[model samples]
Target chain A: MSPVPVLPAIPGPPLAVNLRSAQLVYGGLTLFDGLDLDLTGGCFTCLLGSSGIGKSSLLRLLAGLTAIGVSGDLRGDDGLPLTGRVAWMAQQDLLLPWLNVLDNVTLGSRLRGERPDRPRALNLLARVGLADAALARPDTLSGGMRQRAALARTLMEDRPVVLMDEPFSGLDALTRLRLQALAAELLIGRTVLLVTHDPLEALRLGGHILVMSGRPAIVQTLPDLPGAPPRDPGDPAVQAAYRAILRLLEVVT
Target chain B: MSAIRRGLATLAGVLLTWQMIIVIGELPPYILPNPWAVAASLGRNAGSLLSHASVTTLEILTGMVLGTMLGSGTALALGYSRRARRWLLPMLIASQAIPVFAIAPLLVLWLGYGMASKIAMTLLIIYFPVTANFYDGLRHVPPGWLDLARVMLPESRRWAVLRHIALPAALPALASGLRIAAAVAPIGAVLGEWVGSSAGLGYLMLHANSRMQVDLMFAALVTLATLAVGLYFAVDAALKRLLPWHPANPETTETG
Candidate 1:
């Protein structure tokens, strides 16, 4: 008998979102066809690809925001819907400019019929080092602060799975690194699917990176990072993985 | 260079032209009353004019409130429900097409010379714009915001979502509706009274015109004009007070 491959013990509930022969076509252009994925729980998987290679669409499919093709088949474990239970943060901050920081973070609670827990929201903000800016409105906040507030809001939903679509792509390097660390720390026990074009970001943050190609995506599962996350992206191992992802993206484009 | 200075300069020019015309022409006293003659008429009829003006003011005030409430209430109800929109929107548009002047006498016939006819006329005239504006505002909420609401919250809690997100977003349109209604409200009252009533600025003008008291007719016309301007400014002020972020709000935008 063959021995099973040993994996690290993951703390959260097991998640196995699998897609089989999933095809997406819009207006004669094929975004994806027969794409398949088996997302195992408790690992940060980054889907790396060039711009407009259906990376965002892939995340949307997993998040169940898009409909699966009628002729194609897609399935997930437990039949649990991701909407409201899986927090999806889009590329834009999407904060209500009229609402202050605390209100914005607690917005999920307001949406889900829960009384806004200001203290908990405040704590989350403080964890992100934004406690002092709680009362300020989103328009008054800087770009970095607004993104942090958006991240805090994404956490407020308390979802087990988080799908982030380039949440820190537009930020300056220092702010991006700071937020990347915060995300890694907060997402320790959760299942995270991050989509990014930057190979370095994928290497620094992802436990396992999936490189996708073609109109119909085919996944090339890359090696896992040896150590804990929030890794120094400049490390040799991380650089090697980054180069591999760059090659994958290059080939796909 | 400045808008206020330009406005003042224009006002000064108009007044000078008016005064010159009065001085140069040997015009009939009844045709175009001079500014001084009108002022003298106002002073002479101050006591009686004040009493009549009060009655007209009451009608204007009552009609304006009733019209605004009815218009806004219907707008909100129709806006919040698809059924209301499907049925009521077309009806509202058709109602606007039915001329208020054509209906004023009929309203007087039904409601008589009482304040009811005047308010009914005002409500009918001011309703279309307010309802249309409000419905469009509520309908035009950004798609992204709606997706955020559905993704972040439960279905049962959508009321709070609508209240917090949709209401404020719809406010600018509502303000615009209110401004138009304010301008239209007084005209409705005047038209209602013009058809059948013995009171209000409309009736006073009718009485003066019949008596060949052209100066007095001009005075009532002036009073009506002032009421319309005053009501419009009052709405503008209220809008600024409630929504300081509105683009037309002079204080906030100017200071920053």
Candidate 2:
């Protein structure tokens, strides 16, 4: 085994996100209207819903990437704006095909015109199990490997809050589960808002669970589970919670 | 090796067909010269043909460089500024509506019947394809990429996103534009020469035809065809090298 660069200590404290009176409309369709959301600092929140329920849109809105027709006052724990302090990972790996894995990991810094921290990026790639592919282009890597590189890139941001939109949904089931475990392990003690379609994925990793549903989508919080996540997917309690969420969403009803 | 063989085979076939047509029609050398007579003229007038070919090549090459630079600058400007898009883009479209041939005579009058007129014609011919294709490419960079760039690098300088992302993303499209530009470059230069030029393959062909030198005219036509084909392939090869990351056709290029 090759020696790995040590992961640097995580930067900044985790930030709780508070959104009040959020309204988002897409082309005359109101996705979220006057919706309020609260996710505690240093905790993981999983948001689940069927397609067109606006789970992804809600995440984008929080990211401040909603270009138009959105109104929200979203803040961190310090009662300041949370616009620049959030790291986002989306369903597609979105690694620039022209850049190698290492360069892609440090893309944020380069784009910001800052000197990239090459060692830290290498360490993150190592932590994500992609150190060997540091110089490889995105198209040369498999989907799972590409997503791993993306995870490394996301971690490179070192922000207080992390938002993921189905970051594992595009992978094969086994790869998705493995990546979920990896993401769960790496993202500990950060304000994380994850949107996923899989109830089991939510059961395994969500510290708190919220279901976004309704005509103008609204969130419904579930009762607290017994322990910290990433909980064992095979655990009976996790299984029970999964079934309950399915029933709640009327997936099997 | 196979590419060379295939090219030689096509050339041989073309020559054979030409010779057969001349022999069967009993055409005189003055009207439709025999392939042998054309080759003889090519050898006899090699010096003149080479000089004229060089002149045309220079015009096309200079035009290619200036046109690409101007077109790329325009695309970036159009992309970078709303004012440029709103004001310049309509004018650009309207200019294209005027047939270039109609303006060729005016350009010859203004720039004179020298290399300037020919080079200007080539630049005019190549500019729009490069601009439109490159601008379209710049505009169509996956929205996800820009969104991500905005989120991650909010403090990026005025042109940081354009430089780092949009420009690189648009290169493949720019290459497509260049391919079209290269193919048409010689046509523009020759068109200018035909309208009015001191020296070029077009001028040589016209002069040869006036003097009843059909074989010399055919030789000049061959020289022009060779220059156009050669220019296209050279540009194609250079593009492939410059954009190694952007393989011409990924699915086909990757056999391993």
Candidate 3:
């Protein structure tokens, strides 16, 4: 079968991310040390690792959301600061309970005391299939719907880079697949680094898959597959990649 | 609706019991007035009671406003600066250690016998709970929400995070503190009036008791109780309207 034209090529020159000699220590236990990673920009990279292997911590380091005393040499390809140019989505939807769907989507702008672009926010809500729920409070939505609204908020930032921590982990299989497709389609041109424990999810959504394992975790890239994401789940090539990832994850665990 | 009905029923039962005790014990009006006599007293002294009640109500309201401002302002200051928290937290906790009633005479002495002393008394009683509860709420903003704030907000605009995120997030807690403050506000005002005052239900009750006007004292006591209950409900209703997003039955965890 021909490759589906759902995902457009990432726009502009992708920002490459380089982290060297990164070290994080929590009391007597070392979570990461001498860690090095080179990430291609405008590409979706999925990070797979065992629980407590510091995958989320690595993402935090990249997002500069890590606590103080964390030492690292982190730089973007463009040499510009990565601070305001990146958008992050967490496992929980993290929608402010007080704000309605539309208001949440425009929260960033409102936080900056700028007038929110209501039309753009409404358009994004419509795209997320939540146009009718725009005025509804976030607590009123289901888990999947809340995540979709969160995705709309992430996209509304319109940043060049997006960092997500298990953004679809809480959803059911069907909702997860639908959202993965939507995320791939919507986040096509941005540099995205997603952390997940699901090998199949990583294979389906990521352009590049990296595994972090062992004490003071280190990253290793998996081989690139044939098709672009969202990949055909039934294809043997996808299955082959899936098995390889499963075996690697097994070895790590 | 059912809760209101239950409350009314309970009130009727209490009134019936009070009347029964008075009649069965054959207590004189000075020692224990019957419900009818108290009701008559309330009606007969309505004008005097209303004026005095108004004074106490003003003191409570004024003190509540001032105390809430002082408490929330202090909480915000402490929440934003670690240095402030380290320096002021112990002092705040120590302030609560001294009984507010113990300070009533001192407040009256300092602020004099007018509304200022009564307002100061209520403010003293109210300041601690509002500060403690609101500070807890501000500090306990879900780490996930703060993480989102850090990623989304620039360093220079950090105050925006406090204003938009932390402040609103803490409102439900502040509402609880305000409710508690409203319930106890009258105690301070009445205590100050009892210590030394020209007007208010507290002064009237004291004067009537001294003059053997037992019915008038009962009327003043009833007026004070009504003011306390009314103010509490008013503040509670306002908080519910202001913080509509706060779960009505928050004690139960959501299964979903």
Candidate 4:
């Protein structure tokens, strides 16, 4: 196939999320109760916590995903349900093994019984630095490349709200940094909730950093971000914020 | 050794061993004819044997096609509905309890001594494995993929989950069932022939045995084995081609 021009960048209109009085009670444990959270429209929110905390549950609650035991009044500021408007990305790429990269990226269209827009898919692949590998299978790609294809798939959805659960946590340090930068750049002007263990990643890419802590987890800090994401890690302010948040999430004795 | 050479050597050794056993035992022709006697019988009765071989081949191939279609259909039906699984599964297992060999005469009696009886036997023999394997595949689809399908796909096109995800995921398992079917399919057809038939290699073998034409009977048995082996490899090759994208890729021979 001939090279198709890249798809024009049209950012989705951002939707502000208000999850109010959220409570979750599982078997014998209460993860969180009477907690309020807000995802400011068109801003990146990074959620950092220890493993087994309610970070993922919170993200799932926002996504309206299956079997989330959380009870909350989750609504967009514009008075619309958040379910249909959300796109989800996960730690695993979740690309079907049988499909080539391009087809996987355009899967939403195929699943919806619409003819996939090939040019748009190709353009997204180009943006992800996988234009040449559009016809390549998922198993053939490296971990970073597979995740990039997934990022392209998420971008194709063009939903105003994107909920991601530790989407870059599995990558090597360098690859994770690169993907984090790439995600922040591509996800401009949308509501993005990212659950991650990396405080440095949160410092660099999060427009608003949130730290969830305690048994009945609560959002501790919605730290005031100095500027929009793709933040410079070399800055002293970022380094200082990283040190503080890193202490909260990890036990680095 | 390479695959072809290895296969050839195995064939030669088997024939050599058979000749050795006969020579050592000095058995009568009626007990076990020498390989040369069988070869001579094959050549002399080539035309009649060819007709009978062709009939048996037809029965095997026709049975395979119908069996595969019906087997896969049953598998789909079982996978498609919980109610079908609840009812059909036990009935299928109970059917297996009735030894197929014991029922061969009744099957011939009911369907008559024709191709219909033979085909039904083949279909019955293959149905369970196909349904069980394919249903297992469908049931064991990764929960993550279905979750994605639920989110990405619209609610109205729910069947698309089975089509795009579950069906493709289940193919390798289905292929396995088909392989077993192909290997065992000849037994059903031949069994039907042995019970009661006017044609096919089984009938010819029974006739030759009754007439004390031991060499002709041996020749017909050899022809049946060759047919079965050929059918197996053909199905194996086709199935391998059919599942290029499968996780195992079905091409592990070159690793050595």
Candidate 5:
């Protein structure tokens, strides 16, 4: 028999998520009602808010882990569920205590009943500089190392859209900066949406900042961020952009 | 100053008091044999008793293995499928309320005066805690972690998730169950032997007690206590080795 023809792998459709007339209610109060968000493909958007402005809730909606089921009133455009298209990294780096760094990094794929790919998992671990700690359990790792492992795991799903809810909030300044650079390098062209309280972090990584305030969010999209992200904040254009976002958030001294 | 030194001192004092009691009481030898008498009896009967003890140990080992396999398999079944959890979980709880003491005689009647009866008795007693502990571990994984699995992993990495996440998360609880089961397994075997068996440590104790061999009875009782402690330590050591990341390991205390 002749050699069988090998088919090229199918490419995923571009990420285009829309939240149309979405209403969220907790207890007697309404968090956001009639909220509409239109996100095009390959844009890094940050949702900036105060402590209780539902930034994490929005991320939960995208990830589909929230109490509200997908059958509820909220609908995502492009005929795909919000969760199916997006991968979310929560605030806490919830690595399993028993698994080492490499195993934890590959957990997402493993848990969803996928075949084990050790080399790819190792490569991702190496990317996060956790290749050396691959055999060490999560409890043996430092806080920063755990978070990096979580990041590598998040990247392993190969989802088109990535949603992160305050993934770097608890880290020290120096470590946070280093991770910011790592995230920028990792999330080059993926459709990224993140929730963060830190204006500096948002400005550093996000190409577009969406301020979520009031009952529903009133999004302000800012394009043309200078010198790209992972750039130093001391740059003049970056400083200007920071000031502009700070003014938009209305952080009065 | 040290806790171990204090503990040793306490134990020596207790032994001295026991010796004083034996000297003062002038008790009948058959009723209250002295520690020295019991020791002599143990030395004299060591060969026969050790063989009987070995039989009981084998029964405990067989029961422990079978019971753990059943318990873990049930826990895994209940964990992955909700329908099984709804039915089997309640049935497991109900089984615990029916005392093993009540069922040991029945097991002996059915399986005859043999190792099978002793193993069944141990399995009945040890199965509950293992299943409950492991099931709790499997079901109660953190929501954030499951989300991490869904988002980060592909179709292939799911089994690794169960091993790395489900197994470890449940381990502390499972260790607690196994420790309880280990002690109970020997007791269960002895109870079964007491009901029907002609050999084993339980039978030896019963025979010695009926014949007014007080020293021999004390020897058997001491052997049982030693067996329990040895089994406990063995299980503890195995758990520590299996899970080096577990908080029990002193070498990995830095993270905790």
Candidate 6:
């Protein structure tokens, strides 16, 4: 358990995201229409919604992982296109089974035909408690371990903005709590937008909690809670915010 | 160990049954040679048989390599381009509808009666299976993986996505195609030799049968079977080694 090294901040100021009049339709079904969202830079924003409420779809739109013909007006705070500046983590780990953990973490660099920074990747893996599993294949890992590896890979990208879609939804309670804390520590000062249905998760990790609901999905920001993320999940203030989020979800759905 | 034992036991049982049929039917040596006679013939004509066997093996190997390369190349092209899928896929499928043996004579006419004609025939036999299986594999990459690729890699790096992600993911499927191609590779070479060839096991079989050398013909048949089975196992072993990430079936562990 060596002390974690300080990660250099991503170059340039974090870029805020703004979506205006964005619409997504599939097979004549409107998933969202004229959706507007303002995500402040360097803030951990968690989106809460019920199943099939277009939470993942909105994240995909922000990450630019949407299918062809998806209509949208998405821009950064600098009024420039937001492509190539995002690191996305999906619900599934999506680690290449053919690659070992070390190679998988360095995938971004390898894909760009640049030499993978192996020491940096190994350091990140150590922070995620996967330093010894660097040579192991993804198929050999358990669900929580795989997600941790995915987190290490995501952090290796060093992108200013990170979009995560229910990254910890499948983990057990204890593992989820531990990973949430690790993610918060590693992703500090980066613009992170995490989509999850867990109200408590939003309270524990998000600085700004937004609930997405309705047929044509819209965003409603939850009341800002006291203290930074990795806050006490059992704290009275955090529990109150959790109840408020559950109630808001109840009314919206 | 059990699988090999079982296979050997089955072969012995079949041989016993064949000998029984010969005994019960009271067939003469000229009409149907017994297993003993075939074995004796194999030993007696080992020299000539070995030469012809080597020629057939060369034809099958050459054709297998060429066919796999062409088939997988075509599959990659079809997988990458919608226009190629629309225009060439149908034609590729239609070509398979025509029996490869039916084109043997034409191949011999064009490529001549040497190893070229036999190799061409084997390649034709192999091309369809390799193309169809590899293309299916390439097309059916897990959607989650593709979505990850879309988010991580920019549009300018599409080639990288295909190379690093799609290609490696599709290898197991390609390996399967290669295995099938190897199994059938002998069929094309033998058929081509039958259509028109001065040498090869198929030609030797025809020549021996014409001269009423039934034992020699039986020996040639045995050699061809051994060659086909041997080639199939070689390819399968190579594929297993190449795809270490592909989990081997737990229920059927390899003892050897």
Say which docking band candidate 5 falls in.
acceptable
Q: Which stretches of candidate 3 lie over 4 Å from their true place?
A: A1-12, A251-253, B250-256
Docking class of 2: medium
lDDT of candidate 4 over B117-232, digit per residue (tens): 88888777877777678878888888777867766753646588888888988888998888888898889889989999999999999999999999999999988999889988
Deviation of model 5 at A28, angstroms: 3.2
Residues forming the 10-long window of minimal summed lDDT in candidate 5 chain A: A2-11
Residue B73, candidate 4: how far off, in angstroms? 2.5
Weakest ten-residue segment in model 1 chain B by summed lDDT:
B247-256
**TM-score against native, each model:** 0.86, 0.96, 0.93, 0.92, 0.87, 0.96
Residues A112-133, candidate 4: write the lDDT tens digits: 8889988888888888889889
Interface RMSD of each: 2.3, 1.1, 1.0, 1.5, 3.3, 1.2
Error of 5 at B94 (Å): 2.6
lDDT (CA) for every model shown? 0.77, 0.89, 0.88, 0.85, 0.78, 0.90
Write one digit per residue (lDDT tens) for candidate 2, span B83-162: 99999898778767877798999999999989999899999899999999999999899988887897897654657888
lDDT of 1 at A17: 63
Model 1 misplaced regions, further than 4 Å? A1-16, A19-21, A66-79, A170-174, A251-253, B1-10, B23-26, B46-69, B72-80, B154-158, B245-256
TM-score of candidate 1 versus the correct structure, residues matched by position: 0.86
**Candidate 4 residue runs with Cα over 4 Å from true position:** A1-12, A23-27, A68-71, A250-253, B154-156, B247-256
TM-score of chain B of 3: 0.94
Clashes of each: 1, 0, 0, 0, 13, 0
Q: Please give, for every candidate in the order listed, the TM-score of chain B alone compared with the true chain B.
A: 0.87, 0.94, 0.94, 0.94, 0.89, 0.95
DockQ of candidate 2 is 0.74
Instruction: Please tell me which predicted candidate would have the highest DockQ against the true structure.
Output: 2
Q: Give the TM-score comparing model 3 with the true structure, all chains together.
A: 0.93
DockQ-derived CAPRI band for the predicted complex in model 1: acceptable
lDDT tens readout by residue for model 1, A101-195: 89989887776667888877877787777878999878777889899999988887777777899999989999999989988888776678899
Candidate 5 residues B1-256, lDDT tens each? 6767887997789778877887789777887787789889999999878988998998999999999999988998888878998989889988999999998889999999989999998888899988988888788877766666554543335566676566767777788789889978897899999999988999999999999998999898888888888898899889878877766656754322
